[model samples]
Target: MENKRKELLFSREDIQNRVKELGKQIAKDYEGKKILAVSLLKGSFIFAADLVREIDAPVRIEFMTTSSYGHGEETSGHVKVVHDLNMDLKDYDVLVIDDIADTGLTMEFVLEHLKAKNPASIKCCVLLDKPSRRKTELEADYVGFTIPDKFIVGYGLNYGDYYRNVPYVFAFVD
Candidate 1:
């Protein structure tokens, strides 16, 4: 079974250590500020939860579900919002958390939509960054790992909503 999955990219312990570091950085940066963590749902759920716990400041949480992979593995270059954030962004520093930044279309779409609400600030944090597959000019403010141009699954990353429960990251070979 392991052979069929190629090789482990990032192990479970690897992600945990990185997430802890990211949380510390975020906590220090927003020490005395009103931070709102807007986690991209379905994929970033686990990462966001773990990250927020490491922060030692008062912060609020909200979720936004957007997908450019409507029914396929490739990005459609168009994002659709399935769920919106519940918090009002009148005066808050918003940190958009995502599982991975692939083609960057979805993050770009979400960023634009969130910008319209007039938040005080908006920053991006991703668990994985696949620079090879990027089709747009976008960079994550914080990233846990920089992966190659392969379809990865595990540690909340998935294909068709599978392998998200896998404890480690692995390349999918078909």
Candidate 2:
């Protein structure tokens, strides 16, 4: 598996530190508010778990499974929700969590959908932001890292759903 990666982009320690910092910022931003963290599933699960632990404020965690990339490096550009949120989002401040924002289409779709539910406010928090690949005018409110355009895998990011369990993030060589 090591041969499949060109080099490490982020070490496990680096990712941990960044997540902690993001949690602190989030805890401060929504200190006195009702925060409902909607974690976009499969990819962001690991990150969401770690981030929520660092936050000092009370937060409700929910999972929403949305997909745009199906076992491929690039998105299909057609976003679909495999599973929707079960809890009511009305009057709750929502923080949508995602692993990476590559094209921004999936996040846009999510935001539009969640907006209809009448949440108090909606913001995005992403672990990685690939601004070079963005096809829409959307930005994450909290970003852990601004990465270059590369086929990254590991630390909950994957290629063909194989490398997500890797502790560090890496760019696929081939």
TM-scores vs. true structure, each candidate: 0.94, 0.96
Runs off by more than 4 Å, candidate 2: none
TM-score of 1: 0.94
Q: Which residue pairs in candidate 1 collide?
A: none
**What tens digits encode model 1's per-residue C-alpha lDDT throughout 15-54?**
8899999999999988888999999988899899989998
Error of 1 at 65 (Å): 0.7
Model 2 pairs in collision: none
Candidate 2 lDDT, 1-174, residue by residue in tens: 456636889999999999999999999999899999999989998899999999999999999999889987779999999999876788799999999999999999999999999999999999999999999999899999999998888889887857779888988675
Quote model 2's TM-score: 0.96
Measured by C-alpha RMSD in angstroms, how accurate is candidate 1? 1.7
